[model samples]
Target: MNHGIEKKARIVGLFLFIGIVTGIFSIAPAIDSTNYLTEVNTNSNQVITAAIFQFTMSLIYLGIAILLYPIVKRYSQSLSIGFLSFRVIAVSLSIVGTILMLSILTLSENYVDVSSNNLLEIETLGNILKSSRDYANHVFMILALCTGNVMLYLVFIKSNLIPKWISFWGITGAVLSIVASGLVLFREIDIITVEYMVLNAPTAILELVLGIWLMLKGFDKRILKADEYENPDSCTLGTIHNG
Candidate 1:
């Protein structure tokens, strides 16, 4: 029984759960992505609210990779690195975009007092920035779930480091999340639609539940023992390697 690895699993779960939870808060008030002008006028403080949430979420997103690396590397070193890499790009884009979002507040503030003659230019620039942030969200989401999460869940499914059912749920959730993100990206569906939420619910709930399970129950020892027989020195799966 690798108590060390057990502890790692719990920590990974904790971060994953918190990351998702914070992600929700980051986008709170559910500011409309498309209706920027209205959002600007109505939610004047939205920039501050969004920046706070995005920053918190970005840190947690990176934390998830750091926590999961050791547990995941035990199964496949390359795959673990791939997972971390995707997360890095995803989190970096999100953080940078968050900083850019700060400008929206200034833009919004100006919108309140600007001359009517410049309204067109101000609205255009504001919309452009809003669109860029939305695009970044779409790109990072696809990378994080499709590339990073897919690899992570696939490793778990193959190695039995976690329960097959939980792993399968993760895989399914990843697929569903990608589908949800795709619809938003392509304009087939809006960002804050019920259909979108329903599609993404699987992955969101998956992380929350899996995180709690890992934190509370730890890994199923029988499965971990089985994995130990297969890979004696790898930590969890890919990231942790004992000497």
Candidate 2:
């Protein structure tokens, strides 16, 4: 283990999470208007600020993935690489959503400011962009976030590199996230529903603890060495069972 990178990974993971929370909530009250045209006309500055925050959050995610990859690869090389890919997809989707959001701003400036009712087609296009933004966000959170976490936590568990409790909590959260996303996708339940929050809260808390644990404790040398073997799983499971 590169002690330097380990320390950096934990710190980066912590800030990466903070940035995500801050970036998303920064514009919530000021710019998150339901009426898109009204939002564009009245709070354009806030809307732009919100988009910037979102873009920054996506960038932070990239950093998190890169920082964690080295640590995770020792556990499962394939999953470590897959983690990067999943996060890349998630980040790309987030950027796409940001683009759609800015496009709505463009629509408002070009058409809504001029004539809202005369051209039903323009209104339709704006609505489509808005819908696309929402869907992109959904896919990012559902497919990318859940899948990535599942992969990470499973490797952590298998390698015995982190506390089993943390890994289990994270795995539970990943499972719930999958279920919550399925509910939203199929049932069309609102994303803001209690169900989603309930599912996400555990993972959110787990991440905070994980960051702290990694910073203070780092990965166990014994487990890290244990993972050098091709069949770390059998050894890890046997230890757990004997314990």
Candidate 3:
């Protein structure tokens, strides 16, 4: 394996693991509850922690896209660019969701101090913020992520960067993720339900597996060597294979 590629692969894998862990923590149960507006003030610490985790996850998402672009672009520039674009969209939506979460927390703080005469208006605003956060975090953000994963897996399949089976699994998982997000967007299924969880399980599991695989095995050596030959001008410091 090329040392540079090996190092990059491991870094990507590490980012993936961190991103997944942070993503889970970002969904604080208190904030996700139906009575969040009433409860957020009491659970302010949890909400703040969740917001921090969410912002961290967004940074990881962008980092992964940037790191993979140079290598993936060698296989298919258009697909690589598509993957990067979708990742950026996902990150943007995730940041928006984080901001909405913090806004809700602020609203909750104000809720307790407001007079009863203003309670109804405050609750109404809270609900709107909650709904907007839901769409940003669950529906549109997930849709962009799944779309990016599809393009990424397609590149993997074409380039044999990873095993064919792993690529196929990623593609399948991405499709399932998209379906889950679509259902959420259409109001056919709510977030945090068993149905939504079941649909998203595959992609979640695939990412865990892929992260481990990349850390342990890196990209396929053959493909790295071949890509180096085909795109010498873009190649980083790596050994050339004649065989």
Candidate 4:
């Protein structure tokens, strides 16, 4: 198998696994909602479980992304820098996002458990939930935007390891993510609808496509070693090889 293809397959596997785990966590919230209506205390445990599951999955995904960056870095100079930089940003944002999600889940579960909520107390809780969600979405959206641009630039300008169109799709997905996040934080739109359609699903699909392509085809080792016909940059193909 091509080296890139193998890496892509691993990434696809990781993302798919994340999707499945997240789906399971999503269901827990619905179940907890039902428990809320039925006056059951089971929701707390469920929320805790969901939070743990989500955090674990996110950490695993970040870990895999971090590990892969260095391996891929060696194949192409331009791609290496971009990948490493992205890994740093993604890891940071993702950690913060996970914290927010977990905090929201904790707060929501507690709210559901409370028997009586004063108007002032309810308002405070609402603010907390809203703030947590908003922060998570904002940070994640920015990371997505940066990731998309970096991927596009690396593929289109720095290296030709993967097809140009795949990177383009990544860019599109990133744009949608930004829009979706903005709507969530600024437009008072339905969270589930915008997140599922415009951000999460598309980003996952794009990542899968790109990952598979990379693992199967690997990177173009020569792209990093090439020189521009005129006004070559120091990181240009030829310079990368010698440097």
Q: Who wins the lDDT comparison? A: 3
TM-score of each: 0.86, 0.82, 0.95, 0.62
TM-score ranking from best candidate downward: 3, 1, 2, 4
**CA shift at 227, candidate 4, in angstroms?**
12
> What C-alpha lDDT does candidate 1 achieve relative to the native structure?
0.76
lDDT of 2 by residue, 25-118 (tens): 5343322356666658577787788888888888877787877776677668998888788888888988888888888887877765465465
Residue 8 error for model 3, in Å?
A: 0.5
The C-alpha stretches of model 3 lying farther than 4 A from their native spots are: 236-243
Q: Looking at model 3, report the run of 10 residues with the lowest lDDT sum.
A: 234-243
Give the winner by TM-score. 3
- Which digits, one per residue and each the tens of the lDDT, describe model 1 over residues 152-188? 8788877777788998898888888888877787889
Q: Report lDDT (Cα) of residue 5, candidate 3.
A: 74
Q: What are the per-model numbers of colliding residue pairs? A: 10, 0, 0, 11
lDDT tens per residue, model 3, 1-243: 366777889889999999999989998787779888878999999999999999999999999998898778878999999999999999999999999999999999999999999999999999999999999999899999999999999999999989999999998988888899899889999889999999999988988999999999999998888877786766743333211
- Which window of 10 residues has the lowest lDDT sum in candidate 2? 24-33
Reference-based lDDT, each prediction: 0.76, 0.71, 0.90, 0.53
* lDDT at residue 232 of model 4 (Cα atoms): 54
